[model samples]
Target chain A: MAKTITQEFTKGLWDEIPPFRLVLGLCPVLAVTKSVENGLGMGVAVVFVLVCSNMLVSLLRNIIPSKVRIACFIVIIATFVIVVELLMQAYAYPLFLKLGIFIPLIVVNCVVLGRAEAFAYKNGPVRSIVDGFGIGIGFTISLTALGALREVFGSGTFFGMSVFGPSFQPFTFMVEAPGAFVCLGLMLSLMNLAGNK
Target chain B: MVDNNMVDTNKFIVSHAPFWHDGSKISTRNYNIALAALPAILLGIIFYGMPAVGVISLSISSAIIWEFVFRRVTKRSNTIGDGSAAIIGMLFGMLLPATAPWWLVILGTFVAVVIGKQIYGGIGANPFNPVVVAIAILMISWKDLFDFNEALMNYDFDFAMVYPLAALKHFGVSAVDSFNAGDLLMGKQSGGIGSTFGLGLIAGGIYLIIRGIIRWEIALSFLAGVFITALIFNMTDSARYAGPVIHLFAGYTLIGAFFLATEDSSSPVNFIPMLIYGVGAGFLTVLIRNIGVYVDGVIFAILIMNLTSPLLDKIKPKAIGKAA
Candidate 1:
């Protein structure tokens, strides 16, 4: 019943894409997906946190007692989240500023904790790393896709550059909070449809 | 006695209560609603010229087309014949300025049908009125489009070109003096294409009410709520708030009471709940108009009340059962 190495990596891409398939970690998905810059930035940060946390959790799986596994997982995830927060602040100050509390919020992201409790805690370090990377990439793709869709239509721009001519009236509704919910719902349904096929 | 040739129609017809259908159809209701709206649309066309016709026709066609295409794609049974899509389109068009861009109309219909109606399982299954949802989104996106003064500036009528609500909102109560009860009643006010003709809307509402298409309780109570609330606001400060009659005649108030607020699925079925929902919406409408940021509050108020409809529907008649 064990998945091959490649299977482990690829499952996260489509089969368990975070926001679309697993529907995990929606706070960053909805809040940070206002633009491609914010989305991709947040995605990279999560990728780092998920990968490092998974690696650490897998390494300590044997030593960590089963009674406090969740607490231990949180401790490990929070460490990596801080590491991500610092790295982003040093190298990507503007993005860190834009992402604000959400960067630290990654510590409690159910996706990270879920992977630790469900996968890393049971799997070898190598497989856990691969799983985390795969899932992280899937999360990134979804965030970026949602961000692109929202930005292009909502602002008549892509990555802050104009997509349409000057006369193009932006559908500003797509940028609002309600618009985020609508966009997320639509993307979820589309992923469902494609998966069914 | 069992003849092999006998069809046994009554035997198969044994089913749930209310077996008599009253010869009514979904198509009949939808078409009747559209027909009732015709007078207002005609007056809008008369006032706004061919642009009005174009917006309306395009909205209706595109909405139906969207519904049809969505059904085909989803492989559901074709429901475009039900005329719900047409009614949604018609209502959406009725809420727009005659000068609305072609793309806006198409996008609005797409929202109304695909996102609003079909995505919510279509027609009566939608939690909110599809047209109201569409208009609310459009209003949020392109606030300038619904600005009657800017949108209808070119048209030269003998009366003022100011939108009463906008005038009141922006320039205080004095700026709206030109829009008296007579002019507003005569459909001389500047507003959405089909929403300004007060006479036509009342007649249409009355016709629908008499025909039992829309519940009279909701419509009458909604108007009474508007009148009472606006009267109270006016009495508190006559110089600040407009009178009750003007509030009733202007913006989406009349159309909303008759059409939008009385939408079947989103409204309550029980009598007391219907009155409460109606009054709550009317009160919110005035409250928002007098104090909120939006120039017109009818759609938002109705939408807010629509959120409470399911809970309100709990206030229903107790069934005769062995256990409470």
Candidate 2:
């Protein structure tokens, strides 16, 4: 039983990543992913929502009306999202501004809702919490990877710090939409190739 | 309508047999794509004036030449007659700055035709869109040349010895002030030969959709992604980044999103994947412009999506129980 719980907890980190593997939570993955800072912030918010919602849903699995379970799950998810929004505005003001509409938009992130329906409602609270943590970490890692790559190449910076020497000229396209695709494509391909091994 | 004079019927069948036999089909809509590019061609002549005309012609001609050379080198049957290479060349030329040197335009065509389109066994065989691939290469290698603001400042209606980015880079942000949004819309500003007439590209894109040469989802999603992302950024700090409308209307985005990125071979065939592809491209374009080094992101977004086409296709609606 303990071994099974460990498997669920670790699965989302790589074996079932919300973004790179399952391809969920793409809006934020593409939207707030211009820099590593934004990616890290969103990633944390996702983990918060995922863990809270998953744990709550798992605790109430037997009680939720099957027909309206989805509706009930959404309400729970939305409550967490609102809390996250308030926290970001109050504390992480700069990041809140950077993330902008995306923080509110997290209410619709397929990853949170997906776990609520697929894993949380079926499993116990402890297992669901583990699953949420794993998936959220996986998402954060992928988004950070793509964000760092685009920031460094496109702008010659990393987390707003210029890494390129004085004479270094930036490949401006790297920060643009085209660069996002190129970097993500190469990363996805590399990820896929590595996973194949 | 099927002219025997166009080809020895046997050679046409044999040469095209691989595409047909391999179950990769070509559609008449591809020809309509050529038709869609007509307005862009006319607009190229209007903006950046005669110099734009030279770049357009050079791109189309060089694309044809390179297609022939690539086919000959690979010992494959010549497929340039299908008008696809010509379309790519015309689009490539249209995307280039009117003030660009002839050699640069020719080089861009070579990349689009040979390295981009033909290198992966020609046409449908390539993973990424050829035009986007060529534009990306040029944007990276000749970073200075792709700067619209710089090009506009240096050329100032004089095409001679104009290297636009040099002026912008040297004079700083002050040089960019001369080319405002109004001039950019009206085609008076220095920009890619045909894309300067933002209205013309939009009009042409609409025509292609009406003619069924292209679908609206990919184009709309791309525009939507750029608009939404830019809007959020602009709302937060309007002083730094341009608003969503400016990001949408500026540069070659309309042309690139509608005509170039929506190419059948490079985009996913299914609606869902295509929607994801468009949104992804749009998101990337905005991210790049705001934080990236380049002002354009359409080509890069399209190429990246093209690379992911196969994987996106794999995520089909769940089949009802095939196996355990």
Candidate 3:
């Protein structure tokens, strides 16, 4: 309880980075990370949802009955997800099409729900907002890193630009479903290695 | 559990009763398996010439290098001395087309050594054969590269002698007459570098069995499964299915039966489980070849059976005096 607000914020970046460290919200991590753009887009959307939900949840934490806390949390998270989905449709139609049902499914994302129950419900709104941004940015970084690795090898491209040139044959397997798991595993181990030091 | 007298005791005073070490090391077993595979490899090199030798050597060397680098990076104890990487490399090379490109060979070995073997805790801990894993992934990624007929078309060959499996799959049983059983057995067929020569595979398989390096039950029962299934289909509708002999000689059938299916650790250990694994792989191989979308089913079939081997191991006999 004596921990500073900065410590709470910084923990999400490395000490408890989602997907790689905390290992939460893997549904979006594995599903939408076929390319770097998709990863970034998905990451930014989650950031919006997480920050809003966290601030709202922290403010209502004292009012909502403990028995109905989960139901209340879902309602808060679902509203933010709808805002994200509609905003994506208006501003980024192509990316929205690429991410599809995954944007709506963010309501069920464990990382958002986990932070709501574990962090926001216990902390002040200011700290909760900071925690959401920190964790949301961490999720974005992990997703982008995974997507970059897969895109470079799997498609021989980076953000639609060819990195390996014309002659390079894409390792098609890296873009497929199994490649996502393999990439996720390798990156997880690497994160653990860095964390160990 | 009470069997201890069967241990081959030396003249010296022995402390252990039930333990049996045939004075064989892991390296020795690896070397023996490598030696057994030599006849087929040599035949492949003779037929395909320099390209064949290049693929074999590159795959073997790269496989070793990958294992050594991975171990060094992870700071695990050096296991390259055991010769398992060499065996994996050799088997993978033999399975590839002689014309396989340089990058594909390097990448395939990386997949085999790193993803397939070391990632699963190295050597005996892998759930599926390393060679099979690489092949299956490569097969999924690059279907065109594996099409033998297309890949090897430039070589001096008769078009009439089409890839036996593709021919049968596309043209039906009428294409069977174009193939000679004797030619297929003697390495006159078109296929993977070492997989074409049926006689050499049989020789290598027999060597492995005789050395007691691999259990004969798995290999023979696998062949039996292929033969029986193919035979049953041949009798029921000869027009639709090729005969049992072609099923045994063509594509990856013989190699899958003898080498790939018999990989240690991934395969069942007990007697009954071994039989079931072998037969199941063989049955699926034929089933896939006849009806499935793929031209040859040996690798996929063996991989599927490898998945089932752990569950099949549970089918062992109950302990004496224990409740059922």
Candidate 4:
């Protein structure tokens, strides 16, 4: 039983990584991942929401009826999203402005609700929290890597520091909408290649 | 028994479709295209001087290198000997300013060969012309680099310094009068290295058409489309829109009509679809020039048409001896 719980916790890291492997929650993945700062902020927010929602959903599992489970799960998830939104607004006002509607839209992020329905609803509170953390961390890693790549190539900077010399002409396509799709596609291909090996 | 064994061995020799050889080879086609482009390329060198030569050489070498490296990395067969990479590099170089930076040439060729061609599984498989794709991306990403006015600012010319397309785009039709149709045809205008030589490009295009290297239908229809569309716009508002002759001789129109639009594997194989694709591209080019933000619409227009090529190729005439 202990081994199964541990397996659930670790699966989200590789077996079911949100953005890379599972391809879940792509809206924020593409939107806020233009820079490392925004990606990190969004990733942290998602982790907070996922952990809280998963724990609360697990705690109320027996009381919530199965037929209305999705509805109840959404309410629980929305509550946590709002908490993260308000906290970020109060603490990180600039990031809140940058992230804009995306933070509020986290209520609809499939990853959070998916975890609640698929894992938290039937699992114990501790296992649910671990699962949420693993998935959230994996998502954060992917976002940061994508953001770093875009920033370095698109603007010749890394985490706001100039990495290349002044002579470097940034390939601005790396930051545009098409660039986002191409970058994500190339990353996905690399992941697939690695998996095959 | 010896006769029977020989017949069985001959029967065992398997072959695919197209068993009949027409004596056409990819290398032959590529070399012919290079030969056809010589006049315009020579004119570019004469007008732009050594920098033009440098850009062209670097573009060709870098394109070939990129394809070679990509094939090596992907463990695919080496394709550098076919000369398609050289042709792509040359075409891409022709589209750039004579004063293009070395890095831009290298990067543009990389985009043309690797992202534009190899990523789509290499030559003959790409849905769009590789050169067009690279040029479009460069134009979008670094508009300033492609802006002939700034890129060629250091050079002195007997004619007006402003590129004809830019002048028409920014200052209206009146600004284009500085360049007459004769001068534009004679390659006296300010533009890309090879695109300015209208007469040379037309001659090259005609040579290719004669050699059966490209379809004349596409080239003729594209020009016709441009002429008719520009004529309408000129009639509507002569003060706002330049005439058809100016439109044809101004930008990448000639090069695009002959070399870029008729790129095999991205163009239609049927008669009606070919006409439609060419006319559509020419129409969009004029439309984008007159109203859209870009100064010249050749690249975008060709790309748009290329996107519709697959769908248009479906409009086939009924096959002979087949039910309608």
CA RMSD per model (angstroms): 4.6, 14.3, 4.6, 5.4
Q: Which pairs in model 4 have colliding backbones?
A: none
Per-residue alpha-carbon lDDT of candidate 4 for residues A1-197, written as tens digits (9 for 90 to 100): 45477787688878888888989999988888888888999999999999999999999999999999999988888888899999999999999999999998999999998899898998989999999998998888888999999989888988788999898888898888888887887788677756775
Model 1 lDDT at residue B247: 92
Compose the digit string of candidate 3's lDDT tens values, residues A1-197: 66788987888899999998788899999999999999999999999999999999999999999999999999999999999999999999999999999999999999999999999999999999999999999999999999999999999999989998998878999999999998899888877766675
Which 10-residue span in candidate 2 chain B carries the lowest summed lDDT? B15-24
- Which prediction has the highest DockQ against the true structure? 1
Pairs of residues at least 3 apart in sequence or in different chains that clash in candidate 1: none
Could you tell me every candidate's TM-score relative to the true structure? 0.95, 0.54, 0.94, 0.90
Candidate 2, residues B1-324: lDDT per residue as tens digits? Answer: 233212334456322211112122243555666676677668668645677778888888889888888677555677777777888888888788767777677777877887676755566656777888888777776666777666556454533232222333345434444555555555554567777666767777898777656768889888898889989987997666666765676666778778877886677766788788888888887787677655566677777778887788765566588763
Provide the TM-score of the second chain in candidate 1.
0.92
Question: What is the full ranking by DockQ, best candidate first?
Answer: 1, 3, 4, 2
Worst 10 residues of 3 chain B by lDDT: B1-10
**Candidate 4 error regions (>4 Å):** A1-11, A165-169, B1-23, B321-324
lDDT of 1: 0.89
CAPRI verdict (incorrect, acceptable, medium, high) for model 4: acceptable
Compared with the true structure, model 3 gives a TM-score of 0.94
* lDDT score at residue B186, model 1, on the 0-100 scale: 76
Task: Provide the DockQ value for model 4.
Answer: 0.46
Which regions of candidate 2 fall more than 4 Å away from where they truly are? A1-197, B1-30, B154-185, B319-324
